[model samples]
Target: MKHLFLTLATITTLLLLLSTPPTTTAANAADNIVYDVIGEPLQAGQAYYMVPYDYSDVGGGGLTWLQKTKVTCAPYYVSQENVNTNFGQKIAFYPQTPGQTDITLSSILNIVFSSFTPPINCPGTSNVWSVAADPATRLNFIELRGSRGTRDLRTWFTIEDVDQGGYKISYCPRNRRVDCGSLGIVSRDFGRWLGVNGTNPLTFVFESEEFFLNKALGTKSYAA
Candidate 1:
């Protein structure tokens, strides 16, 4: 009778354990926290200035500031300059999943330059960044979405925290697992442009617009 009672108790405990939902732990909480340069958690739709994680590595003594190429229709691509003009380009993220307030690491999202206004003659209507072949260079480069189809998997990207310490952008369409690469700078005749380089991607940090404004006013650090 004792052996039977012990067996029954063990089975009951196992059943209860299997039925309980998994609880959120500290590690799960950490997964949700992606901090900007100001040290605050990054949120969807918030504007930020992305600067090279190692500012000194950029050419011409300028930190790599992401800006758009001033080209004619169908080739308005994203390029980086080695200089800081004012506060630099403002970027924002839109998570693919609806209603998600905070942008988390490894989440599929659409990156957009908050200040870009497509030219009247531009081919695509979208300002959302997408990886497409540059008509001019015939090389795969980041360009505005739309002409390539609204649902193109190439429009999707993911943000991940690099093991070496900063955030890196990667393009790995869910539909095509084989199509994957990390974004880095490539030197062109015009200037350094953003491209899907190999494994060694350029990592960057986000600075809040408000932080720049406050610093300009001689105010204390925004993180303070």
Candidate 2:
């Protein structure tokens, strides 16, 4: 697959937002958070290609959420579509349960992603901070499962944030196979790959549930 690769000159759009995230208020329980891999917004209702920090198609070739499952993969994006609850299914991801999908800290972040979309230049507008949590336990988690026989393998991540410089934060690991935690933070001084050129800071934002629901539904954009 082809993850949209933005050259230094093309990322002006994201850079502008990144530089301004500092003005945004700290995330509260009831806010829609923005998260992304490589500084792109995970657009709602849009199926997108996803990859781990370890993998790269820097030259413009890589796997996506639509490909064979791996330790980390996703065509993950936000949507009003009811999140898949059937654990038996191939894939699922959501920030909160339907009934209590409140944009509050108490709800707990829950995101379940299953599926793959190959590499392409990743868009700067489709990155989103999906706060996946259990409907019952309300425990924070980021479930990363493989396909079929390997699907049972998973990891849980607790969401945390930073506001000083861009949207700095990590999914701090709760469970998984190898080198878990730090929930994949790679920035100023953390994460799996350090100081790679063209990589984005693992940062994000939280917004009101109502705010994002509308954005997902096409009733709004990030301007609100």
Candidate 3:
């Protein structure tokens, strides 16, 4: 009788554990599993594409479906050979438009969103980003590095949560202790959502991390 009772209790415990859902993580938002490209988490100086994704899409290994052609921020120019070099390597983004006293992350996001499709529709652009993974904080950040003009530039970004392409991005605060508590983020590309003062960190999300498991580099649209 004692052995039977113990066996029943073990079975019940196992069943309950199997039914419980695992805690969601930053990378696993809504179970958005991006496997990686050729053992990804791309290294610094290694070129990759920064393409655009729809608000309802979490880009990943499912091929012949997700359109990989919408890269909004990158500009393309024809080479002398008459071939277009994918977004012309890495391009530098202006921190602020010329002669602007103040700017919001909303404006930047709107610009990128608009560029994703239409007048400024940029194609796949190959670029490199440097990783800044801190083991202590477990907060890994990346900075896009490429030649812009006479000087090379590095743009810092941190990705958090779901909404596919629409996630939260903010530069690490210089103060290091300034944390915006419960700062809610929305999904509209254009609006007066989150503003930035000189002191406050600019919060926005760009399609910084686009991945592919078995696909080739410079991958564009795929039709199912």
Candidate 4:
């Protein structure tokens, strides 16, 4: 009788334990996963095509795609393309945290643009996204760098999900602590440029490299 009672109690406890769901702490719950266009989690070091959030919203007469172009035959500044082009669309994201393969919202990371191909030769040092040190421009213009880390506050950026729709990129380097600035378009030199300013931040989406290649090179749309 005693053995039977003990066994029954143990079974009850096991059933209760199995019925209870595992606890998810606030920290874990708050880590919102940023997904790609196809609803897959974005991974660091993987190439992605950064496309503007809404194609029709950007009323500028052309596609609002991010691309690289030199202003005065110098360092390539990130510029907006009115139409689609083969070059300057590929970019890779690097997380600030070590061993962090999955990119989460509000996490600090470095954006690096891929190198330019033939004919469009522009001798630049680095492709890591960084702000220009131009005192005249208030360091709003985005430029490329050879290397960047936690120590260099100018290199760190954060990805945030906009309330309206899509996501927006911000740069808030650590100066004692992290202070992010909104990234938006600043019109200059008869061109739309990306900079840290009061203008509306450009809402954008990440299209996986695979889809971009298929749509750009092949006939399949790969809509998702």
Candidate 5:
């Protein structure tokens, strides 16, 4: 009888240990805080792409060379139709290329949008934001506000896992109410990957609860 009781206790203890969540190290804890904010890690071996549209200079009229005249510029505006019609998907990264590397635990990819067709009307003009993948398992973070400018727009996205089949994504933004509003469109499909790499680039897709048009613009238009 005693032997049977001991055996049951041992099994219970083992099961409890196995069921517990893995303990996160200090570095991992910090990374979790970051990943909790962003969506997932941008892997090295994988490829990424983005397409941006600026309507600042879409409309313009100048005089001929013979007759130099100072002419007023026409007001340019970018509508949803213009974005959907004119902009074609652009690849931000191509893994098959020479320099492309599979995203590992310790890798960082930074993409900045500087020039605007009409100049980004956002509050801060000069600034740099980045998506950083640290040396942690399936973890990534994004720093929206950098040393360049300050206009209260900050957020992040993460790539949690990537393999032969597909990938997973997550989005967490600071000041959700305000930042979410400014992000525009692409924000809607945050935690989903339409398609990683296949026949068509424009087919890339994602799904999430907090969807925004600007976020979609960034993903579909910028990171197509």
Candidate 6:
């Protein structure tokens, strides 16, 4: 009887352990996670990409800064699209544009992602995707470098679209100089946008993070 009871207890314990979900540590949780908004209110039609800015080496000029990038959208969905990545793991984004008279920024601007071909030798590269807007702004701010020990990149962005009578003004903040070879970044205001009325300037901001995973290409992983 004693042996049977011990055996049952051991089996139950093993089953429980197997059924239990994996718990992510606080530090690991910070990696590969998405942050909605920080520092300012996110406008409806504006979107921001939180590109990671890693500054570890002065001689190399912080090669990790190259991983930073930006993608803008009018509505929130469009921003989500910018975050979407598939097997190849390329980064893509949309541009900002003026909203129609009847449509507000909240309705016109949104994040959407489609298939793309990334640059050569860049894992998860993307192709020439469409912007879906005219007179819009698009730019690359930084580049990523070799992997660190579970240390993912982090960055933030904001988008704003304010009504200025006959037209609308949109602005996205970008870094001016990005050293891909050395993976260094120079902090300069590369603010860009379209439909500026010269009077009322609308602004919005959003933040996001990018993690460099070691998983094999085309493998799927989820953060629950």
Off by over 4 Å in 2: 1-99, 105-108, 113-153, 165-169, 173-201, 205-224
Best by lDDT: 1
lDDT minimum window of 10 residues, candidate 2:
80-89
TM-score of each: 0.75, 0.29, 0.27, 0.73, 0.25, 0.23
Best by TM-score: 1
Lowest lDDT sum, 10 consecutive residues, model 5, at 59-68
- Give one digit per residue, the lDDT tens place, for model 3 in 160-203: 43343333434443344433221222112221122112122222
The candidate with the higher TM-score, 3 or 5, is: 3
Question: What's the alpha carbon RMSD for model 2?
Answer: 21.3
lDDT of 6 by residue, 20-76 (tens): 876666445433222333323333323233222211221111011112134331111
- Candidate 1 worst ten-residue window by lDDT: 59-68
| 47: Cα error in model 5, Å | 5.3
lDDT of 2 by residue, 1-224 (tens): 13455565468777887788553465442254444433334333333222222222121211212211233434342221112111111222243334442222222333333343424553321222333443453333332222222212232223444444223224343353233333322222111221111143333333334544565578866531
Q: What total of clashing residue pairs does each candidate reach?
A: 1, 49, 1, 1, 44, 38
Candidate 6 residues lying further than 4 Å off, grouped into runs, are 18-21, 25-30, 34-36, 39-224
Deviation (Å) of 67 in candidate 5: 27
Task: Please identify model 3 stretches exceeding 4 Å from their true place.
Answer: 15-46, 51-88, 91-156, 160-168, 177-224
Candidate 5: where are CA atoms >4 Å away?
1-5, 12-47, 51-179, 185-224
Pairs in clash, predicted candidate 3: 169-204
Q: Which lDDT tens digits does candidate 1 get at residues 36-102?
A: 8767888888888776776555542212224354444545556675564434578888888889888
Task: Between candidates 1 and 6, name the one with more favorable TM-score.
Answer: 1
Which of the two candidates, 1 or 3, achieves a greater TM-score against the reference?
1
